[model samples]
Target chain A: MYQLIDPILVAVLLLNFAALGASQLRTVIHAIALQGVLLGVLVVVAHNEFTIWAVLMACAAITLKGIFIPRLLFHAIREVSIRREVEPIIGFIASLLLGGLGTALAVLFSNTLPIAQEHVGSLIVPAALSTTLTGFLILTTRVKAITQVVGYLVLENGIFIFGMLLVEAMPFLVEIGVLLDLFVAIFVMGIIINRISREFSTVSTRNLSSLKE
Target chain B: MLISQIIVHVVLLLVMPPLLLGVIGKTKALFGGRVGPPLFQAFFDLIKLFQKGSVISSTTTWVFRAGPVVGLATAILAGLFIPFGGHASPVSFSGDLILFAYLFALGRFFTASAALDTGSAFEGMGAAREVTFSCLAEPALFFGFLVLAKLSGSLSLTAMLDGPMPNSWGAAGASLVLVAASLFIVLLVENSRIPFDDPNTHLELTMIHEVMVLDHSGPALGMILYGAAMKLFVMCALLLRIVAPFDSGNIWVDWGIFAVGMLALAMVIGVVESIMARFKLTFVPTFLVAACLLSAFGIILLLR
Candidate 1:
């Protein structure tokens, strides 16, 4: 079971590195979408239960995170017609180094935490923490609003990985509500991205400094 | 049995490095969609270089002469301390890891000083870059050594390497993986490969290691090339031991596995060179720093 699940988790981690190093906005979006899909699959593999609740949660996660969010972000990028993330606050290589450091910290930090009995020896928590740190890295370093949205999605994917640990404890309705909230949040952010592009004629958040006054 | 193993070790140390270089060349050529040179190309080049006359600059001192000689000598000496495929090193003692590392450092110190001895601006620049990047690489190497030390509870290179048999992987796989990765990066950087420095480029301003040897000719240049291959072989052997970590307990099978692993590693390095362009000069430090963080992380993972 672990042999199967660990590779997927590793792929997700590599996707984090790819997203962090990618200079193209489209690549970043695609990497985040792949990570989301991997997380959805992880939910199924991690649970090993195959109950109705687990199946539904995985489907919802796949739909909202993998399909819905990426499509929305891609549409936003197309509307803005921005192809690359130029002049990021932190350079791509530096951000990648920071992402690696974050992953190490996450691994070390996870060791100190009190993991549930069933998830012992599993990489769930460290993967989740590292993914979240990578997302935070992308969020702060990238200037494109669309890239920031992708970062936000990656951060949520990390949270969702952690949330899988509570599948047995948390109520089913709560999970659905959380997915619904994510959908709405991205919807609202999409609208804001469109507005920012229209107002500034470029999707770069660097231009948004005018509104600081 | 021990004498035979030592003979095999000496033969491999002498004959294997040039082949690895040829493998990398052929792999790169294949990637570029051209017919590559024969696997014996480096061997032929070494022979050709050894037969040529020297070209010493009037301004150069004895330091220029000593560079390649010391470099080759230190690389060969360093090989004595590294075990191959679960075989004990020819020379091993407590605290040998420190000797193993400093031997490379001693070679670099001489090489850089020789480059400076040329009094050429380009060689000076190359020497400066070599020293600067090595500062970052050395730390990563030490941290990797630290993890190995912790893993085997030994300061000796042979013990540290042979101690981590197949069974230890079950216990500290994650930490080992991190260390192997860091060591691979160090290998790439230390050898002046692509994503760090391109060895094949003709542009003098862009060259690092090649530029340092621009003034060297004949046997001296051949010695430098041979020394580089030896360094690459030693580092690749170190990484291969960690990554493969398989021992069948038959000496012949073990040697065969080690040879195949080293060749495959060369091919991997070739693929990396073909796929990735060198990083911008300013960003090279970032890459080395990342390597350091990786080994440091390995240490952290081991402690946890």
Candidate 2:
């Protein structure tokens, strides 16, 4: 179970960094979808004993996160004329550097804690947390609204990895509830992205500053 | 043992958040010139809202109703891990802080989603600002906790604070000021208070959390407002936990200090509210960024 969880978690973290480094909106979206699928696989493999209900929930979560949300966002991108993510607040190299720093920080911090070494492997929590922070950094640094949403998804993936630790402890009802909320959140954010594109004539969040006093 | 702990945890979990709100409200009022309404004002408000039926906007969907309940449930569940007075939390284990933080994000996500669901431009604007500031604020918060864990050499909040790690008043003071300041910004922003926002304001342009719930009424509205207040109190309690040097043995004295600290913090917020005007919207992020910088400073101080 630990082995199954570790590789995917690391891969997702790397993919999140890759998304941050990408200049194309389409590439970022694809990377996020890839992460969603990886997380879906993780949910299935990480648990000690997987029930049919767990499998179904994992599949549903994957379907929504991995497939449906990306498709909807792609459609929203098509509606908007802006296709490229030019002039990210941080350059690609800087972002990669920051992602590296974030990862190192996670590892360094996690090592000092009393968590048993054998439980989830050494890298899982720190890597996930670092990836989460990196995603957050990208979200704030990027000017494009779509990139921000991608950043949010990356952050969500990071949280999901951490959530794996307490699979036995947390009620499945709460898990499903959280998943449902994320689905609706992304669905609604996709709608808002479309509206923002139509209203502002660009997907850049910079334009939204017009309302400021 | 397990069953009793679970029961106790569940009961305390359910009861503490609302009472925290009551304490803050009463404290803020006392700080102002007048004697406030009863501390149970929130409970009274909840009851009144239950009796009154809602007036739903024709434009609104089921999303509006679902949003508040989702936010409240997420909050209550998240509260399970936060150690109030010094007992191991109900769901204590490694990486619990991550869940605690993310659960709050779950609340914000729903709140933002419901705001957008209304299709009102005002609500959308408020949601946008909320996300923007929180983006800066959340990392600062997590980093502060990371430093606290380092200082105490414990993973969970209950352990990190109550464990026998040597507490440096300087490091603790810096970190506490940093975290408390960041959380104070969060308290004002999350609760839609003055400076970040004016809770009393009806104009959509000036709204943060308020406009999001413009369409919700009755029990739903009550839950959202009460939940918002509870969130403020939760953050305050966390702040108090950082500042007040209460060991695991002296739980009663710790609870007393916690209560007193809660009032002091609320009074400080009220005073700040009375003195400050709402910052210009663009400038609000700058204020939050300042808090984030202070948190970073706190972390660096701990490292040194």
Model 1 misplacement above 4 A? A2-18, A90-123
Tell me model 2's lDDT, rounded to 2 decimals: 0.73
lDDT of 1 by residue, A1-213 (tens): 445576677678878887887777888888888887887888778677788887888898888888888898888878888898988899887888888878888887888898888777677788899999988988888888888888888888888888877867888899889889888888888888989888879888888776654
Question: How much is the lDDT of residue A137 in candidate 1?
Answer: 86
Candidate 2 ranges beyond 4 A from true positions: A1-213, B1-13, B16-32, B164-173, B248-250
Which candidate gets the maximum DockQ versus the true structure?
A: 1
- Backbone atom clashes (below 3 Å) for every candidate: 0, 0
Give each prediction's DockQ, rounded to 2 decimals: 0.37, 0.02
Per-residue alpha-carbon lDDT of candidate 2 for residues B175-293, written as tens digits (9 for 90 to 100):
56556666667667766778788876876576677777888889888888767766776676666666665654655565565566667777677677767788777656655655554
What is the iRMSD in Å for candidate 2?
A: 12.1
Candidate with maximal TM-score:
1
Instruction: State the TM-score, rounded to 2 decimals, of chain A in model 2.
Output: 0.92
Worst 10 residues of 1 chain A by lDDT: A1-10
